[model samples]
Target: MKRKKNNKTGLYMLGGVVFIYIGLFLFDSAKALQAVEEAFGVLKMVLPIVLVVFFLMGLVNITIDKEKISRHFGKESGMKGWFYAISAGVLSHGPAYVWYPFLQNLREHGAKDSLVFAFLYARSIKIPWIPLMVSYFGLSFTVFFSLYIVVASLLQGLVVEAFSKAKR
Candidate 1:
């Protein structure tokens, strides 16, 4: 029943988008065509990332054991879990939205909410940007900010854990 409702909502949103496009086309055909072209261009770039994410999801499902995921990211995972999550976040690249499905898959396999939040928060510390940041803001500022971000990620995770409704 919930799945049906979700599908219905999706269809409605798609229909609304189509109708809006139709209206735009009628109002200004050339502008509408340009909009469509830009939309397709964005999709073309994003599609590959989405495909890679799916491939990674499948790889994770096939190679990583559920018990291992739980051990690393689940309840009682301790500081080790935080370390893993923060490390993964810093290492991960590409748009953050592309990771949502993969994260959801992990959660389904027993990843904790706190760890997920920590991962998301830690993503702000882009390792590749560190050198650039240091050049612009000085080494001390960059280093301190990076360290603060790590601490903040842990706090964010702890807050999520405190309010999380999911059973461990």
Candidate 2:
């Protein structure tokens, strides 16, 4: 039953995409073709990364003990939880949406709301981009920006925790 629902959801999303392209083509054929070409270009770049991410996610789902996640990232895990979340976020690559399902699983397994927020915020600092950023903006600026993002991510987590608690 659940599988059927999931299939339907996937079909709906696929249909939506098809509808969008059709609409665009109807409105302006040349522009629509251009958009399709641009989309394919992006897909070529992103698909490989997405596939690797999914493969890794599968490994994680199989190997990582759910109890460990709950123990470390639970509401009472405190600063250590924040550190782990931020670190994971920084190390994560590929598009953000790719992380959503894994993150949602973490949440379901007792990961704190604050840590989730921290993880999302800390994703801004891509390690691979550091060299390019330094070259473009200078070492001092890049270093400072990275540090600021780390700090801001922690702060954002704290604020999210506070707000969540208040709402509850």
TM-scores of all candidate predictions against the true structure: 0.77, 0.82
Clashing pairs in 2: none
lDDT by residue for model 2 over 12-106, one digit each (tens)? 99899999999999999999999999989988978887787777667768877767777799866777898899999999887788787777767
lDDT by candidate, in order shown = 0.87, 0.84
Q: Looking at candidate 2, what is the lDDT of residue 118? A: 90
lDDT of 1 by residue, 61-140 (tens): 99998898889898768889999999998888877888988998888888988888889989999998889999999999
Report clashes for each candidate as comma-separated counts.
Answer: 0, 0
TM-score of model 2 (CA atoms) = 0.82
